[model samples]
Target: MSYQLTHPSLQHDRRILLSITKWLLIVGVSQAVQIRLSASERKRLRKIARGHRSPVREKLRAQIVGDAARGLPNTVIAHRCGVVEDTVRKWRGRFAADRLEGLKDLPRSGRPPSFTPVQVVEVKALACQIPADADVPLARWSCPELARHVVAAGVVESISTSTLRRWLTADAIKPWQYRSWIFPRDPDFAAKAGRVLDLYAGIWEGESLGVDEYVISSDEKTSIQARCRCHPSLPPGTARMMRINHDYERGGVLAYLAAYDIEGARVFGRCEPSTGIEPFMALVEQVMTQEPYVSAKRVFWVVDNGSSHRGKKAIERLTKRFSNAVMVHTPVHASWLNQIEIYFSVVQRKVVTPNDFTDLAEVEDRLLTFENRYNATARPFRWKFTRNDLDDLLTRIDRHQAAEPALTEAA
Candidate 1:
């Protein structure tokens, strides 16, 4: 036993000696590696280390460099920063070699892109065009369908739908979605739209409208149905939604003709079995025969091209019937410019959407009653879109049209 030195305490002492030797070797290696920074570099490192907004990795690198600059050993820096000694050593070496730039990750190696720039352009161009234009049966491009079409057209040999989707996402391009739009086909679209916008601004032919003059936007809400629910509508309760019966009995349909005073914030409306010259004229009489309008200097009526009031004949008929009334027709397909449409949309939401009336009479009552309540509190819509905005919009459309041929040729 004496010869083998078999005491347990002696064995433990030997293990302690080995551990101490290993630590000494590591400390010696770390001490031998020194990092020095220039004055500007030291200042930058200090700022980055103390900055609250600096990225975590950048802050850590800055701390390592700052500690190294102060001649702290790598082990001490690692302990202070709660990182491995190797991490401290690596960044220290990087800073000493390439300064700040070396702290950033190097360019990574990967497979080259599957699609070339021309192929990408082709795909995006196809996405913008309608499917019919491209002679495809589909209405719109699905990502997979687009990928197949690209391959079939020899734009590329093969491509993944996911890869194409990723590329499209990066460029904010989506071929699968669409919004309805119409070109202002009316050659006189600019002139006509400008007059309406000006009237809203209280100007007429470069002159401010007189206080006695009134502007009215008139339109018809057609085929409003009265649907009697098979069951009564359930009122909303705690943690429960208001339930409405999807199935209902047909209670009949009615048309609502309404005139909205653009400046006066008044509404005149009536229910009719159908919309035609006679019914529309009744609404006109309802508004024009009233006290202020009856004696006003001018009553400008803005209307759209419907069978009830279409073209020059309708204009002559309205002006002749009431000498003080002037009919202004909005461009075809441009009812959005009328303020009265806004009021009708509100009525549809508040009065007619649920469609729970027992008969058409109830529908009429609710609409008329709501109109009175609305007029009591309604203010003139703050219509800010002006002739200048209309001009800018037209200019953009012209530029887009001018560019279309080039895009088509390229495609």
Candidate 2:
């Protein structure tokens, strides 16, 4: 038998058997660990196992738990996965028993809502109801009023002012600020609203031209100093501090509104000696005539609901002359929609504030300078209120009107 040498094939077979036995031993021993999980724990394990593995440690554990075949040592895995060794061991044992479903996350612990969803909805409805039978004097709602009314509805134990605020913030409700609009009872409201929407919508959809008015953005500002008190008094070569009367009743600063739109690029303002309708109309006409043939498809004006603008004859004249021109009126008591308001605020802060004017002319000059500086880079206003807003407003107003009974026949 060739000197009794061991057979090579038998040796190889023994080595293979040993390797197989080693893996079988590891698998059998690993699977023997038993960790019984309650329903909640099973759910929690499943949740932790979701999604792709991240480079981070917990993500790797999730990845391992996600797959039933992959196995890591309890201690090494726990450290790598940012979980305690006990948790890793427990999860690994349960996962072996239940497969991939064992990694679910358990539901959170918290108090149930005070009000059911249906009751919450009813509460919101009651809170939105107008205070007066008619939407007058009390146009919009205050949080305190809304909370009081909601409490009266008996939906909740009690609604606190702070509670109402939390609801508003969480639910994204803003009832305090006034919105720009009115329910035009005119049967032609839909048509008129459509027309208005068309003009603004085109500014983005197709083309747009800037529209606005210059009323003497003028307002009376009091406490303008007649003399400079900060500088030392001196002769012609010396500096002198001017003196101004502190009496506001005697005199105050009068600022004007001179506004301009330059090729949808610059907004110019001037403070005129007057803010009369005549000057306003004159400036509007100037804006209309001065515009270059500049490929302007249309001009849309965003003006406040000032009486001067609605002057029937003047409006008719302007509308008839410019077929594509559309005038949009900011709702009564809703001046925030007008971008000019923002510009005017800026002007007040930067150009006209923290100083006293000796005369209206000085004030006007400052305003004019500001306008010139701004108009150098004027741009058309991009309004966002769409047809949807108009529709909702109309529907609400219509509902209010429809719900009201016709005036009872006078006896």
lDDT of each: 0.90, 0.55
Candidate 2 global Cα RMSD = 12.6
Score candidate 1 by lDDT: 0.90
Tens-place lDDT digits, model 2, residues 1-411: 462226887778888999999998788557645444457754654565554543344445454454323344555566666667677766676566665464444468789777678866765665565556433347676888777666665667786788677777777777777555544545655665555455445443344534432111211222333232244333343465544434332234454544423225455343444455565565555555664422244556556556556545645655776654546554454454455666667766886654555555666667677777776655655566677887887788777777665533321
Model 1 / residue 157 / CA error / Å = 4.9
Clashes of each: 0, 31
Give me the runs in candidate 1 sitting further than 4 Å from their true place: 1-72, 77-86, 89-114, 132-135, 152-154, 183-188, 235-243, 311-313, 392-411
Q: Point to the candidate with the largest lDDT.
A: 1
TM, every model: 0.71, 0.49
Highest TM-score against the true fold, candidate? 1
Per-residue lDDT of 1-411 in model 1, one digit per residue for the tens?
363447888888889999999999787866655777788888888888889998999999998888887878877899999999889989988877898998888898878876689888888888877888878899889999999988888888999989889879988988888888999988899989988998999889999999999999999999999999999999999999889998999989999999999988999999999999999999999998898999999999999989999988998899889999999988978999999999989998899987899999999999999999999999999888888899899999999999999988997
Q: List all candidate RMSDs to the true structure.
A: 7.8, 12.6
Task: Give the range of the ten consecutive residues with the poorest summed lDDT in model 1.
Answer: 1-10
